[model samples]
Target: MIADSGLVDGLRPSPNFGERRGHSRPEMLIMHYTGMADGESALRWMCMERSQVSSHYLIQEDGGVVQLVCEADRAWHAGAGDWRGRDDINSRSIGIEIVNPGHEHGYRAYPPAQVASVLALGLDIVGRHAIPPENVLGHSDVAPGRKQDPGELFPWADLAAAGLGHFVRPERLSGGRFFGRGDSGEPVAAFQSMLAAYGYGIDPTGDFDERTRAVTIAFQQHFRPCKVDGIADMSTITTLYRLLGALASSPLAAQGGSRGAIRTA
Candidate 1:
């Protein structure tokens, strides 16, 4: 495949891509960590047809970038998931697989050079596509219950500072009313509504079920990395509220997709 970005250091075409559906161009960027022993193994896996998985780009631990699929095609990276009430994420997003022994092997911090490459490539992709800041998200954000790659250790704040994704200073943790699985009420429904409004695939069912917990954990991993216990604490709630509030002025607002105001009480 032809390289989509000039920043690509190499090319390793994979046969696991197809034409994009429902959308002509990508509107989101999804980040992931190769959950394997090493970068080579991860690369080979993506190139293997049997694996049934491929991303548009892969950033090695040493910062080398390999383009597996052209930006115009739909790579088989994002599995079953939805964002902003839309499905077929693979058709609407560009996927970047950052090399790291993820939570399975030996979860660790991303190195400096690798992170720099990610930042540069991310900036390029988002700029070219005009992807909104809030639309750049981690795999966990799209498929909360089934996956959590590019986990909590990923430097989301750093990327946000570098003008990639949307982020805010997380609220400080403190004593307050919190909700978890099995809890159901208007507050829980409100929280679910906020999550749904922010693009997560959840419903305002008024029940903090397994899906709610998983989505909460995903939100915390991406936004409130200080804690990710799947319980909606004051910190998580306030952080989400502020993040939604910030979206009013983001590029997404111009697209008529801005989230409605949510009450955090």
Candidate 2:
């Protein structure tokens, strides 16, 4: 198969992909970590038909990019997840597996070369597809509780600085009124609503349950990496608020509807 991006340094086609359903092109970009010992191992696993998993691209530690699945096909990455009330993420998103051992093994910081490669490839994909900034997300953001690849240590702020994903300066952490699992009230419901509005798959149940905690952790991992305890602390709340506020001027908002609007009061 032909590589979709000129940035690809190599191609190792995988048979674990199929036609994208319901959508003709990707609407979102999902980032992931291989969670293996090295890039070669990860690449081999993805190419193995028995693995049943593959991503559009994989970037090695030294910045080499390998295209495994064609962008026109749905890669078997993002399993069982929803974003913006929509399921079947594999059909609507392009996945990029960054090489890292992940939390299970080492979970070290990504190298500079690899990060630069990610930034370049991300910009290229988003630019060509016109994907909105808010649509660029981590695996945890879509499949919270079940996965956390490209974990908190991943350079999300760096990616934002390079004009890839949506991000804001996280509020300073401090002692304040916070909500956790077991809390149930209007406040909890309001917080859940805000998360849902920002494209996270959450229900405004008014009860801070396990699902709520998982989603909160996911948000903190991507936005407020300084702390990620699954508690809706003031820092987390403010960070989320600012992110939603910035959405007013985002391209998704200019699509002629109130797609990202949420009550900030």
Candidate 3:
């Protein structure tokens, strides 16, 4: 099969894909890690039709890039997830799987070579499709409660530095008031609102439920990587505020871009 991106070094088509629904083009880029002992195992699983999971591209630790599914087709990567209240993520996004022994096995820092390849390939996809910075997200970001493939160790800030994703410098960790699970108040509700507004799958409920903690952990994994304890510490809340502020002032926000679904296969 022909590769959708020139950056692809090999074509290893996976049968676990289908025609996109609701849209013909992808509007988001979902990143994930293999979460297996090795890249080849991950590739084989994704290629098997029974596995029923595939990503458009997979980058190995040595920087090799394999194109498993054509960009125009919808890969069965994101299972059940929502973003900004939109539940059809697979229909509107391209998925990339990075090679790594994820949390369960033995999560580690991504090798420099792999990261370089990811940056190049990701930039190519983002530039060609014009994917919004905010739309470039980790699997955890889209499926907070059930998924966390590309975990806190993933270098989101590096991607932001390369102009591939949205990010803001996290506030310094210090002593101050914070919120956590079981907390119920208008402040918690407002915090939830900000998370929802930023496209996280969350309801603005006044009570900080377990779902809120999961969402908070996801947010911290992506933004405040220095710490991700599922508790909304002073640093986490301040970092969220700063990130929201940054997004509000971004050019995309000014144009009133919809956070729902994007189409750019």
Most lDDT-accurate candidate: 2
TM-score of 2: 0.94
TM, every model = 0.94, 0.94, 0.93
Which residue pairs in candidate 1 have backbone atoms (N, alpha carbon, C) closer than 3 angstroms, thus clashing? none
Tell me the number of clashing residue pairs for each predicted model: 0, 0, 5
- Model 1: per-residue lDDT, tens digit, 1-265? 5778899999999999999997999999999999999889988999999999999999998899999999999999999999988899999999999999888898999999999999999999999999999999999999998999899999999999989899999999998788899998778887887788788999889899999999999999999988889998878888887787788453334323312322333
- Alpha carbon lDDT of residue 38, candidate 3? 99
Query: Candidate 3: deviation at residue 50, Å?
Result: 1.0
What's the CA error at residue 47 for candidate 3, in Å?
0.7
Model 1 residue runs over 4 Å out of place are 249-265
TM-score of 1: 0.94
lDDT at position 167, candidate 2: 94
Over 192-221, each residue of candidate 2 has an lDDT whose tens digit, in order, gives 877888889998898999999999999999
Which RMSD does model 3 reach against the true structure?
A: 6.1
Instruction: List the RMSD of every prediction in angstroms.
Output: 3.3, 3.6, 6.1
Candidate 3, run of 10 with poorest lDDT: 256-265
lDDT of model 3 at position 173: 91
